[model samples]
Target: MRQHLWMICASLALVTASSAMADNFGMAGCGLGSMVLQSNGKEQIFVGTTNGTSASQTFGITSGTSNCKDDAATVAAMYISVNQEALKRDIARGNGESISGLASILNCSDSDALGTSLQRNFGGIFQNTISDSKEVAVQIRQSVYSDTTLASSCKAI
Candidate 1:
């Protein structure tokens, strides 16, 4: 159908744009939805719904495909980069879904503690005009390592 083709083309265009700028994935995480919907903002809700409905996110995570397979650092960085807007809001508040998700990925035992730590060092982790996810990830890791309790608590960071 023409509508389907247009949607696919639009999705690809979004993916290309986001990938070129930040090498970021969709808010749906890793899955078919992520592949088809790479833009941020409200479109993320659609992406998440698609992934959830299709169960591709589970498959991708289990099978290590669709951007699910990567080193801890790389995955963490990609997550941080893709969820910058959420992270920005949550980090300012010192607790939210983004922080919780990051804690899970980084294998931290205490999501609240991690969120607090990130909130405490918000300025440093989110420094001026950081376009690179890897850079932001490194800063986050460094922030975690700087805190003695958090360093010991987060096994993957």
Candidate 2:
């Protein structure tokens, strides 16, 4: 009976250690410049743009889908498409001379401000669609902004 109790204690210790290791690794992997958050209350996952960087952009799901972990990649792809479209629009509208301006526009002064702008912009674009697929698209937009910033930052560094 004592041996069994010892074994159980050992198992619990292993589980605790494993979880700590996972958390540490996850944080380390994200690195210094990146931000990370899991969706908790709502189906929305917001990725806000970074400050003091021309790569500020916000990505989020306003309504429709919930629990976006399974489709992260797909959502990321869609964001790329949306950003491309936004770029084209910006160019046509004479907003800026180059794609870099799009980057600047996305890189608003603050993350929360960027998020508010994105919610307004994307809300209009995705108003008609249903939630599940639309949410994935929203995720894609967020991914585009985040990926673009990361890529640009890497190039700068």
Best by lDDT: 1
Error (Å) of candidate 1 at residue 99 is 0.2
Candidate 1 per-residue lDDT over residues 35-70, each given as its tens digit: 666667788887788789989889988997765667
TM-score of each: 0.56, 0.27
Error of 1 at 141 (Å): 0.6
Cα deviation of 17, candidate 2, in Å: 2.0
Looking at model 1, how many pairs of residues clash? 0
lDDT value for model 1: 0.82
**TM-score of candidate 2 against the unseen true structure:** 0.27
TM-score of 1: 0.56
